[model samples]
Target: MWARRTWTDGDHGYLAELYDRITAPTITTHEPILRKAPDLSDAWWDSLSTALDAIAAVANNRVAVRQEYLDRAMPHYLGIPIDTTVPAWTAAHGDLHWANLTAPVLTVLDWEGWGSAPAGYDAALLHSCSLLVPDTAAQIRHRFAHILGTPAGRFAELVVITELLQTTTRGDNLELEAPLRARLRFLTER
Candidate 1:
């Protein structure tokens, strides 16, 4: 479903809207709470390193989250460089995974957490989810790199942080919590 939707800018925007609706609390309400609690994973860390490299390569700039602010610190902790002063926005499907998409026929499900967000957010999400399977993750990253005309280094880091942000804000779902934590720690550690 995403393959087809990727072709239409309108569908992409709509998907972004849906993702925002579902995951609104994380960005708007719960981020502060999660920052204080330290819970994270090894797999998430591995993925975060890759993600950070990818973003750095694509943006061609050093990315760091703001200091003394949890919300800002979190993204930087996960290797996504965000400048509070700069306006760098793009439509994002806050949650984009195979479970949220239908195969055979293209239909993207789960449109609750959509919104305008950092660049490469969707690609990062897709790559992070693919991490569950090594081959799958490699393929996804490769495809993303090809599509974006860049390497998939920091992409996973961005996605992991994004996931952490969501899990922290919204009530913890057992399935997502573990992975999100893992990713969070992975990115935050020096």
Candidate 2:
């Protein structure tokens, strides 16, 4: 980012940011959806993991995923009694999906909602978005197993699934409803 300018217009506020140009195309053209998996190299995965780790290490006061939202959405979406307690929290990209990620060199875009969330929330969100591509979903699971296999990561996945399921009710992400529910069952049952 080069510069940031903020202004208030009566009751609202606006902010404009300047950033260096990204030449690489995003992994997916659609927002929050991944129809196909790109053949990414190990280096790309490593870079992404490192970037996420760096983001998680940052200190921020903003809340992207709230406790109140989790408390209400967990059991309702999972259809079972769930412990919504997140074991760990960290800074996150908040909206980490294929469309927000560039290929060849791994550039994460869209920081409008970046803030604190459950640990591994970014990976969970990315996995959820990749459900349409089973291979990609499995790759995410394998790559981030340390995070996605833990209690905190499982809860974070549940949180993301809940959010996606909620979106389905509004006629969005209709294609993801079945897989999202299946993943919910897997998470809740285990």
Candidate 3:
């Protein structure tokens, strides 16, 4: 799932090492949870909250995201705030999840979405997916806080907002109607 960017064998090796460094600890600590519970948990919610907070902090000081195609499809959708004002950069998987990662070997397979993104984007994505399992979601959240060194409360509001946005966007797809509706209900009820 790597993108069109060509990589030499050396680059691959470096990436592999980086992946191991980033994911090994979490994987080692959480593989059991992944294998057992795939649904979202209270813990996952907490982790998502923390990640969103970090994103919002960074996003608040940056320029707003702008994309013509996304705007066309979601005319009312406001783009996320991204801090382009900073000169720092970090490599991101763009999309990180259990499916793209392997245990024991600690390999991260998919790389299509890899690029420079805000801090904690990968963690945010992982937390988002972890919501599919309640217990694991909790574990993921706990791990996220440990990794990012942020308080979980910092992210709650923004995570809810982002999840709402994602739910609304997915509502257009018939296959996703039920889950999206449930998420919408959850958002509204809260």
Q: Lowest summed lDDT over 10 consecutive residues: which window, candidate 1?
A: 24-33
Each model's lDDT: 0.44, 0.92, 0.43
Query: What stretches of model 1 exceed 4 Å from their correct place?
Result: 1-87, 146-156, 165-190
**Candidate 1 TM-score to native:** 0.44
Per-residue CA lDDT of model 3 for 69-168, tens digit only, reads 2334232332434222312333455556566654443455555446544455566556545554556655655766643334222232223234435555
What is the per-residue lDDT of model 2 for residues 108-134, given as tens digits with 9 covering 90 to 100? 998989999999999999999999999
**TM-score of candidate 3 on Cα atoms, chains taken together:** 0.43
Better of 1 and 3 by lDDT: 1
Off by over 4 Å in 2: 1-14
C-alpha lDDT (0 to 100) for residue 160 of candidate 2? 95
Q: What global local distance difference test value does model 1 have?
A: 0.44
